[model samples]
Target chain A: MGGDFGPGITVPASLDCLRNNPDLKLILVGDSTILNQHLGENLSVFKDRLTVHHASQQVEMHESPSKALKNKKDSSMRVAINLVHEGLADACVSAGNTGALMATARFVLKMIPGIDRPGIISALPSVFGHTHVLDLGANVDCTAEHLYQFAVMGNELVKAVENIESPRVGLLNIGEEDVKGNEQVKTAAKLLENSSLNYIGYVEGNSLNAGNIKVDLIVCDGFVGNVALKSIEGAAKMISTLLKEDFSKNIFTKLAGLIAYPVLRSFKDRIDPRLYNGASFLGLKGLVIKSHGGADALAFKTAIEIAEIEVKQDVIRRISEQVEKSLTLSKSA
Target chain B: MGGDFGPGITVPASLDCLRNNPDLKLILVGDSTILNQHLGENLSVFKDRLTVHHASQQVEMHESPSKALKNKKDSSMRVAINLVHEGLADACVSAGNTGALMATARFVLKMIPGIDRPGIISALPSVFGHTHVLDLGANVDCTAEHLYQFAVMGNELVKAVENIESPRVGLLNIGEEDVKGNEQVKTAAKLLENSSLNYIGYVEGNSLNAGNIKVDLIVCDGFVGNVALKSIEGAAKMISTLLKEDFSKNIFTKLAGLIAYPVLRSFKDRIDPRLYNGASFLGLKGLVIKSHGGADALAFKTAIEIAEIEVKQDVIRRISEQVEKSLTLSKSA
Candidate 1:
């Protein structure tokens, strides 16, 4: 029971994914009764590929991280993560309270060696393919050292998932200028410059979305990253809303909207928010994908896709090896 | 001499503004030779409304703030700000180096009493109306006190410029939850709660563009504000580009795009980045509008319109008085 629809949306999406990918198997962990109601007649069809593991407790969105961790011993989110921890599943995906999910996942899987805290990492649909941005509200008050580590993990993640030999890492800042930013960003820039990564110096937010992607991976503190992510979401929504409003203003425009519906729909599909749903909890020992709490069936399916790709690429092993290498290099240099 | 295009764009933009607004008088500050070349024979036609105030030096974009202040005594940016300082112009507008402009403007006009650093405030076209956001790349690493001050300045700006009494103020954070942001944002939330302003508490980045318009003024430190601003710009561009690409995929879609071109054009015009060109430097003794460095004539014209409105409203005086009153109320409480 996670996200707004809880098991209602998750169950159907998982069933769909399992049907599409022949080798995929899913363990649906939630209130078995509620999930069964949604899966009603379809349970028999997917019985061979799916297992229903019941968890009585659920984490509320308002619950504090520590509170949820202490009280909810049998939450679906926790049990799901436990499956990954015990090596029963390759990865787990959840559409639950972010703080609760992060706290529980960190507690169960633990951090990769040399990783202090697992960061929230997600890919944004940029003009040129996708840009991976890390620490999306995982650690709001990040230090220079934390930012540098995020760059290392994010670099390795893109290399593993996308098969990019050396992904360009960018330190996100207010401006492109070397002198323009808070003390933490400036210090992080210095660290990134000396590190054995393809550091692209400083990148502003516009560069993140522009089709001619300047940097493959953008790194910043959770606060900045989260704000930037949400801002892009808001802008895209507002623009589309404005277009619909304009098209509805008159009969002529309405006719035009009708004639152009196919093109508009195709355009909408390209920039659909659902396509970029899951955010990985990088630096964790096991793969954990956090779907948006308000995600629907389609968005949840996209989140599951992230898990499928990550598991296929062995993202955890790659991130682990890179972290160890970077740590050793830092100590020596 | 000033921005990227120098007098080529600025001179024509000023001329257009002068033609539109009869009461407007413009003093073009830059190299006289370049200004005359751009102005050509049009100088005689606009002679009554325009004057050329030449400055020999120009501040490059990469110049350090301190270096620009000390070395560029006769810089166009400095000279333009001096006109406002000497009561020759009600406000000064420039598209020059931001750091140099801020340093020169602050040194020339000084800050209002109880106001620390002046914030770069601008209007973003939101769903409901335009929302005012401030400290956009002014003070990157700000304290809670500084954030509170930005709220006061931004609140006053919305009131004075937009004529909205008791405009709702929001503290921008990673999440709307009171516990979600860094320590600085948390402390600032408490301060805003206690202040006399109509503080609506924390707002996330999506809320900024979402037409619901929770608050009229969104306040944050410069770093977060800048990133949010750029992210919106990037997303808008990306969405439009994707829409065009979708339309060009096939013959039927191309015809649909042709039929819907007018409605699409109007929609694009509504959210055109040129319309939101000027950013006000608030909490200073005098008004100063910072135009985009790469702004074209149309965009620079919009920036000049901002200066005209602020000057007409006596924004500086109103901001100073309200800031004093707010500070006094806080001290007593």
Candidate 2:
């Protein structure tokens, strides 16, 4: 994985991955010493399945993506992406620096055919179970066409991940009206309305969390999607903080907390960022799951599971077919 | 007030406003019959203080700002703005259509001297109390200059409403780094850095909810602010829904709920959106409060109290001073 916390998180995740999927193979592409220190005495069972490749440098999270890729030849992120490029690894997962990971992926794996930009697709745990929020942090300034492509990619991803036959796709707009939002959103609505996908025109921001809107996939510019995703996380954090403060207020509240403990735990588990950290750097040639950098073992294991599923589903191949067909039709039209 | 619910909410709020400030005079501007119908028996104590304007047209929530203003000549919103325009009302408070209200205010009251777009400013309840979030739903395609003006306006509003000195204003960017985010954010950051205001430079999306980023005021495009605001509401709704579902799951949980009723009520009271529904449409010539349309009497009362404080503080004069200074400096520079 291409991240600052590559081996720190990956070591535990690798262990959990092997335990959960006995046949899974893991190639540690970071500094062998650091990886071994974490791996330690538990390396006996998966010795045959594990391979260590020495990658000396680690990319800092704040480093410029292009500069990091250019300077750090043996960086863990670059090494991992190379492995995927060379067909040595089925998929690559990272919780490290997002920009560096995205940059390296774009540079090494390259964009899939007919894809304009490699959008980051995140799964937000909505009331309707799960909604795929696309372009969470990929294309900041997106056009109408870019959003259209995002819908296509997001739709394909929903199907691959959620096992939906035809996941409903909604264009994120200011309102449900035919004419709402900025020029880009208005144009995107028109394009989405004309698209072959299960298009549910414009959707308001409230529909995302309410899960009242039946769409499994919601597409928008990275600016809006990223803000929306982070806002939800921030709100959840704020609410949890408030609840904790309330519970710790007095003896009565504390005692009440004991009684309400199960419900609070369920709330935490349901909206936990760690549990829902398997974001894909979608539209890339190879499968890449970007888990939260601070994700614990459970979350990391989930990311691995997601990666494995994407590989089995031949997600890239299917996406390529759909995108290419759509592109060809657009060109002809 | 400019809204339909203003009469319903304002009648009780007028009492609270009067109780707090005996000198407060409420010119209830709406359909006289409807206002009296709602205020019936409760009008005795403050019957002498209330003056009604018979406005017939009510702007629908879905109507376009311009269309609503052009078509609905005798709208309560239009009349409310006109009161400010003719120097009859100190401010206009509304729980009506935000778009129509904004349009009416812009057309009648006009922008404060240097303000390009009068932003919709409101204090969003954050983990760390409250932060002033501007452009809640006013200007959509905001330029950097527009955002800078919003910062100035937001800084003034926070000072007026919250009694904070030198409220640190932050430009809502994709990342905190000077190098991150789209061109608009970058441009806005530069303007903020160079401005005379207490500009804190860039802040991330997550910071808006985290309550850790210690800035009193945050300025961004309406799209980002609206999306972020709605997402927070969505998260809260989703969690609340989940909480209700889990509580109603079994007899035991239901029993726990009954036992912890008082504590839960306290928790609900603390986080209730009803108590925090007064959002000010900043940058106009006069103060305009936009309460939630679904507001009850309690929320409406709070809205009136909010309006009283806003008018007492002379928010418009303060905003005018800041904007005038900004305009003169920019022109000379």
RMSD of every prediction: 1.5, 1.9
TM-score of each predicted structure versus truth: 0.97, 0.96
Please give, for residues B1-333, the per-residue lDDT of candidate 2 as tens digits. 344555656667766676777777777777889888877775677767767777888788778888997899888888877887888988777788877887788788777777778787777677777877888867669988888888887888788888988888887776677777889889888887887789877877777768466778888899889888888888889888988888898998898777677777877788787777788887777778888777877787777777888889988888888778886579577
The most accurate candidate by DockQ is 1
Q: Backbone clashes in each candidate structure, one number apiece?
A: 1, 2
TM-score, chain A, per candidate? Answer: 0.97, 0.95
- Per candidate, native contacts kept equal 0.82, 0.66
lDDT of all the models against the reference?
0.88, 0.80
- Per-residue CA lDDT of candidate 1, range B200-235, in tens? 878889877883565799998898899999999999
Which stretches of candidate 2 lie above 4 Å from their native place? A1-6, B1-21
Please report the TM-score between candidate 2 and the true structure.
Answer: 0.96
- On lDDT, the leading prediction is 1
Residues A1-333 of candidate 2: C-alpha lDDT, one tens digit per residue: 444456667788888888778778888788888888888877776888877787898888788988998998789888988999999998988777888888899999988777789898877788888888889978779988888889888888789878999888888876667656899989988887787888877776776788466669999899889888877878888778887888888898899889988877876777777767688888888888887776776778788888888888888888888888896579578
